[model samples]
Structures are given as C-alpha cells and as structure tokens.
Target: MALLAPPKDWYHPAAGAERLWIGIALVWCFVMSLMMPYWHFRGKQNANGTTYTVTPKDYLERTEKFVAANKVGDLNGIPIVQPAPGTDIYLLGRMWNWYPVLKLQKGETYRLHISSMDLQHGFSLQPVNMNFQVVPGYDHVLTLTPTSSGEFTIVCNEFCGIGHSTMIGKMLVE
Candidate 1:
C-alpha cells in the first residue's frame, strides 16, 4: 500500500515569513557595517588629542570615588593628569612602568598618558594596534578604545638599549 503525503502548502508554511526574516537580517548587517567604520574613524580622530597627568594617589582616589558614586572610572593605572574629552594628555616621568594593569570594557574610550623616567624609551603595543612615542621629559598621549575584548601585549617601540624588548606590558579588555 502507498503512504499518504501531507498537503504541499502545509510543508511550506509562511513563505512571507522567510522573506521578512531575510530582509531584517540584511538591514541589520548593513547598519552594523556602516556603524563600525564610522565609530572607528571617529575614535581615531578623538585619540589624536593631548592628555594630562595626575598623581597615582590622586588617580586611585578619584577612581575609588567614581566607583563609590556609581560613576565611570577611566583611569588606566597611571599618574597622569586627566584629559578633558577631545583633548590630548602629556605625562613626564623616568623609567616608570604603569601599574595595576589596565582593564577596558568593549566600546570604552581612553586617552593614554605615557612618559619615561630616566632614559629615552619607546612604548608600542603588539599586533600594531596603536603608536605613541615615549620620550624622556616629554609625555605623549594617544586616545584609544578596544572594540573587542581580549589580551594584547605592549612593547617598547624605542630601542633604548639592552632589556628594551623585555620591557613588556599587558592590556585586558572585556
């Protein structure tokens, strides 16, 4: 005996629904692609400004207060003066290494304050993420935001001398 088959229309239910889903998906992808480049360009422009310096104690204190008050903490474990939005920062130091390892969330924005203590050294991030010059007596600030969450290595761009490559740092973003 032959088996009976279900109705042809029943097997293909809601043909319009498939079209609607595809349309929605396309629109979403288009919007995201457009926004991603726009955000990246805007962030790059913002990162080209100056940054200020603050004492490490003051930086920690302000960060604590920001946490207590439910405000955002943008301090990156550096004793650099805070920069106003859209402004670059300049920090000065000698053979100093920033502590407390910075942690940034996805989409978070930051302006870096970098300087040297004793000799002329370099500050460079691995994977060629961003570029900044760390010179003695002169602080350089670069604005940056990690769009993705992961671990990145920070390497000295300048070749001061021996142990320059060993001067490594780490950045974490969630």
Candidate 2:
C-alpha cells in the first residue's frame, strides 16, 4: 500500500489562531453572563419605597429587642436591624461624629442607610474605602461590607462646616 500525507490546509496557522480567539471570546461572554445578576441587583435602586427613620433611642431599643429575641448579640444600633445576608438595608440618620459605629462579623454583609441628621455632610471611609454624600431631605443607601478584620474609619466626605474634618466614625469587623 502507498503512504498518504495529510492535507496542507489541516495545519494552517491562521485557522488555528482564529479558533483560539473564538474560544476566548465565548469564555468571556459566559463569565459576563454569570455575573450579570449580581451587578443588576446591586445597582438597582429602590424607587417609590417608603423611607424609615428612627431616633437614636428608638434604634437602641430595637437593637435590644432584636438581640433578646434572636438570642444573638450581633444586633447593633442602626435605624434598621441586621439585614438578611446578601440583602440591602435602608437607614436614615443625621450627620454627627461617629454616627454608625457599626460592628460586624468578618464575613457579614451590610447596606448602609445614611442621610444627613441636621445639615448637609459627607460620609467617607478610610483607608479610603467608601465615600458618599449625606444631604438633608435626601436619602442615600450604600451597599457595602467589611470583608477583612479591623477597624475602618468613616469620615465626613462633604464640607458641611467647621466640623467637616472632625466628623468621624468607626466600622469594626471581627
């Protein structure tokens, strides 16, 4: 029997390169699709929803109740209680020194419910982690969490007045 050679076109470098590029593009698309829902839900705004407000006293009382009922000491004083994991929380409060002073576990998640208490103020976290504006009569809710253990500082991002630089808070994650 005579030996036979493969077709020259079978080893064409250009065709091989084209196939590699197509495979990469498909993989990129697949990854983006898998991430779509997370981005969509995170960016979605709660329009036409009621805004809830609570006094510091009311917040403390609610925290106590949550802790007592759940037998969990994880409850802290925000206008809203601890959110279900991966859920957002809407909170309202005036700008003041150390407003939130929030505490959370290492892997816990949180959505900040923030607003001006008396005047327009700024909300900033350091080591430059999160930044937002706190304006009176307007509500701002920021979805965030402390992924690492340590104390992160929250400073005023806006220049409300002389106290702008002095306004600071702490987010402690254990």
Candidate 3:
C-alpha cells in the first residue's frame, strides 16, 4: 500500500511530563553555555590560546634548526630533540609521522609548540593524558609539566592517509 494519508492537522501535542522535561532540558543547555566561559577563564585546564598562522616551509626550517641545536639522540632515523627545562619544544606531524621526538625533564613546564606540515593531525601524548589538534596554519602551544619520567607514545588520533595506523612517535621524560 502507499505510505500516504490525507493531510490533517499535523501538530503533535506534548504530554505534561514532556513539557516539564523540555523546560529542564532548556535550563541545562543554558547552564552549559555559561559553564564554558567560566571554565575557560578559571578552569586552568588546557593550553589552547588564541590561534596563530604558521607556514609549513618556515616551520620545517625552524624545526630543523631546533633539532640540529638540541639533538641528544635518534630513533628510527628521526632526530630526538632534548631541550633543557624551560625551553620551548617544537614538533611537526605530516604525512603519517610525528617528527623529532622530544625529551623533557620531569616536574618542569615546557612550552610545547606543535603544528602540522601537510594536513590536520591529532597529537595525543599517552601515559600523561594530553591531546590536542595540530593544524597546518595554527600553532598549538601545550604547556606541559611531566609528573613522572618515562617514555610516552605520541599517537595520532586523526586520520590522514593509509599509513595513519603506523604513525607513532615517542617522547622521553626524565
């Protein structure tokens, strides 16, 4: 049979409980909307600040220079930049890899500068519970202070290419 009927008043009335639930839901939405700014200014939760523009070429050059100056070791043909505490750390993610694994000291805050060279990537620092989006034109500065010393894996949560599953990096905190 045809899935049609003669047009009638299509308005569906709300039950008493449904009306009460709708009012409660609207109040919750308003509360959540207000909580965002409250947390942003007082939560001390994330390192996300005003975004900035970054050119891939310039970022690559900067990363190379930083790696060259701060090289302390290498892993899988990638130079490891172990900058001293209080120094800014730069890391690049492109194609399917996070370049120049970082080494930081425990209990010291680091201004970790992260950006993408090709496409958007996700920077997930495991065992420390920090993750952020790495965009091509924006530098995401993550203020990190390692509580314990260990080797943390940098796993990309965003899909980029066929090699996304194999895109893994490491960071040593000591």
Candidate 4:
C-alpha cells in the first residue's frame, strides 16, 4: 500500500505544528527530569536511605529480646508489645506472619527497624500509606512518629508465599 512506502519528501525538516509539538514535548520531558531531583531533595516522606547489614539470626535475637522486655500481652500467638517512646522497636517479617504487634504513643518518635527472616517482603501501613521493602540480609530503619491515635493495619504488599495474603500485622497508636 502507499501508506507502507517512504514519504515523498522523507528528508525534509519538520515544521509548523509538528515542530511546535516536538519542542513542547522536549520541554515537558526536561521539566519532568528536573522534578525528580527537586522532589528527592525537598520531600519529607522519602526514604532516608538508612540501611544496615544484619544477619537474620542476629535480627531475630534482637526482636526476641525486645519482645521479652516490652510485651504486654499476646494476640493469637503473637506477642503484643508496647515499647516505650523514644526507644527502638523491631518488626520481623517471615514466612506468612509479622511477629509481635506493636503499640506506640502518638507524636513520640521511635526508630522502627524492619527485616525479613526467610524471604523478601513488604511493610505497608494502611490509611497513612507508607511502604518499605523488607529484605532478608538488610535492616531498614524508619524514624516514625504516629500523628494520630488509632489502630493501623500492616499488610505485605510483596507476594511472599502461599500464605502471603494472611501476612497481616497490626500497630496500635495511643
């Protein structure tokens, strides 16, 4: 078909509306490119890139000790811990569960450390919509200060395993 053949003036320069649209598209692309670094420097909610290498065994031990020291009760089989404000707290993701539901005080900041035991997972806090990746060999720390007092749910956004749909956790802010 004629549509499949080369244009009559294939070597001609683009002009008029075609040139104007091309220039506009280039400007739009440059603006978008600038916005990425602008937001990276200005955004408050971005990840602070604070991660440390940690073995799964060592991380599990630390979590166990933390639970033992601050555990207030047990839900199902998971320990429910109310850690003191301004202290460090641990949340471990493994298999199909998030160990030790955490309770925190509103407006008090805590260094929240998250990691995995077996496979990779996700830490997604609902309503507030903060998300972080949970890797097995690295600890991800988030300086968190819950502004409101309520119960929040944490669901694994990463497809972890067969029971990943059941990998739900809870956080209580008081």
Candidate 5:
C-alpha cells in the first residue's frame, strides 16, 4: 500500500539514484547527438554529395546520346553500354526500369550519373549495398570503383508504382 501511494510531498527533489540515472541518460543523449555531426563530416561511407540541377528532357537526351555512342550490344531490348575507362556513365530511372545496362571494368573508377525521369526513386546497388535517392530534376553523380568482377543487381528500394517490383537492373563488372 505504501509503495502504491505517491511520495508524501508531491513536490520534492529526486533521490540520489534517480538523479544519477537521469544524468547518465542525459549524457548518453548528448554523446549521441554529437556523433551525428562527427560522422556526417568525417565518415568514410558517405556519398560524395555532388548534385546538379537538370531538366528531365535534357538529361534524357544526354543519356540517350551516351547510350547510342557507347553501346556495345543489346540485352532484352535494353542497350548494354561500355564506356571508356575515364568517361562518365549515365543511368536513367524511368517508370518501370533503369535504362541502358552498364558494363564497367574492375579496378577502374568512373563517375556515375543518376536521375529519375518521372518520380522519385531509390537506387540500391545489391551486393555492394550502396544506395542513393534519385529525384526528378536533379542529377546525382557518384564516383565508384568496382572492386570485384561479376554481375551486380540494381534494385529500386523506393515504391514508385505497381511495377516497382520489376524495376531490377544490372551492372556487369569485368
């Protein structure tokens, strides 16, 4: 019965144990808050954060040109492009698919340009686990080097529409 009842005085300083726990919780929260900024500035796993404003029409034209110029073959009606070692690679995210599968060489660094033509999308590179947001009207560039050689799948993690499940794409690193 005594335990169920409130403290005799409704207003009173917290006990020593309660104060200690409160202090520990506050310190923990402060440390967690500081870690966010520290990781944002010094983290190695972060994206390059390079983006540029672009219209969907302009980006589509540029990507189409890139695909036409560097296309080596075709796979399931999609062009398979093999760009030179130092050139930029364009990837377009449209309604239900990623355009023009990319073939990259292992150990070579290339700038990958990603953008969405219709709505916002998520670019998730499987096996590597690299993810980036693909928004319309903006071009996001990621500089990456393929460390291994095999077929890597690019899955859309964002739900755009009914066909989002079929939005899987591919990258061939040789």
Candidate 6:
C-alpha cells in the first residue's frame, strides 16, 4: 500500500509546451465569444434565437387559413402557396409531410414562418444548403431571398418518425 501512495509534493511545474497550449485555448475562447453578438445583430445570419408568441394550434390555424385563401394548386401532390413579396409565409412540419410548397420570386425577400404540427421536423432548403430545426411550439421565422430562379427541393434532414425519409417539400423561385 505504501508503494502506491501519492507523492507529498503534488504541485509539479508544467512544461513550457503545456503553458503555450493553455494560452492558445484562452485566446480562441475570447475570439469565439464575439460571434454571438455579431450573429444576433445581423439578420442575414441563419440563427434561431427567437421564441413563439403563439401556441402551435394558433399558428397552425393561421397557416391553414393562409393556405386555403392563397392556394395556387398542387405541385407533385403538395399544395402550393404563392405569396407576394414581403408577405409572411408559413411552412408547417408534420409527421411525414411539409405542407404547401412555397413559390417565391428571385431577388425579393420574404418572411418565412416555420413550425411543426405534431413533432419536430427538419426544414432544409436544397441547392443553397440552408437548414432549420422545426419545433412544435416555437415558430422560427427565417427571412429568405432567393438569388437564383429554379425549382429547389426541401429535404427533411431531421429524423422524425418511421416515414421520415419520404418527407420532402419543394420551393420554386421565379
């Protein structure tokens, strides 16, 4: 037991190499801290630091009504909502579907309101590589401006349920 006992002088001096590593880590941490405020002020950044003012039910009803009034028909079995520029657009995420494929114009910005109906889903826009986590209660609003005119696919990158792989949506910029 004495052979395994700890040394009385436990405070050993660290090498210069170890001190250099600690100094580098402290500097790196300070630089990363500035990114928080930078992203918060810049609206162009894709960051979710918002809260839902209304419940999911209320949000869903609003989306449903919007879809009903502004329905432009279906694209590949998904309902298409052609909203004007600067208008608030809703994209609901459910068990295995993303309702109402959105249609927007290029070079124009639009407010995209996204949420979930049942469970959390993934709101991913292809070609541009934009992705957002769709929560049930929180309504995440994303301001998007399509620079290119084409048909882009929306993929459900988050695994929600058994049929998650088939959960696909569409977005058209014209």
The runs of at least 3 residues in candidate 6 whose Cα sits more than 4 Å from the true structure, single-residue gaps closed, are 1-6, 12-15, 53-56
Which residue window of length 10 is worst by lDDT in model 2? 72-81
User: How many times do residue backbones clash in model 1?
Assistant: 21
Prediction 4 TM-score vs. true: 0.85
Q: In candidate 2, what are the lDDT values of residues 26-123, reduced to their tens digit?
A: 99999999776766678543222334554555544544454344332332343213335565533333445644345566666665566665677766
Candidate 1 ranges with C-alpha deviation above 4 Å: 1-47, 51-100
TM-score of each: 0.48, 0.50, 0.78, 0.85, 0.80, 0.82
> For candidate 3, what is the TM-score?
0.78
lDDT of 3 by residue, 14-122 (tens): 7799999999999999999999888988985756644668898988898899999999888998888889888888999998889998988888988888899998898
Q: lDDT of each prediction vs. the true structure? A: 0.55, 0.57, 0.86, 0.92, 0.91, 0.85
Q: Write the per-residue lDDT of candidate 5 for residues 1-174, one digit (tens) a residue.
A: 566978677788878999999999999999999988888789655576589999999999999999989999987888999999878999999888999899999999889999999989899999998899999999999887888899999999899999998998999999
Q: For candidate 6, what is the TM-score?
A: 0.82
Please give the distance, in angstroms, between residue 163's alpha carbon in candidate 4 and its true position after superposition. Answer: 1.2
Angstrom error of the Cα, residue 45, model 2: value is 14
lDDT of each residue in 1-174, candidate 6, tens digit only: 467867878777766989899889989998899778877787466565355666888998999998987789898787898998999889898888888888899999888899988888988888888888888888888777888889988899888989999998888889
Question: Sorted on lDDT, highest at the top, how do the candidates line up?
Answer: 4, 5, 3, 6, 2, 1
Model 2 spans with C-alpha error above 4 angstroms: 1-95
Model 1 over residues 138-168: C-alpha lDDT tens digits? 4456666667777766776677667666666
Worst 10 residues of 3 by lDDT: 43-52
lDDT of 4 by residue, 8-47 (tens): 7778789999999999999999999998888888965657
Looking at model 6, report the run of 10 residues with the lowest lDDT sum. 43-52
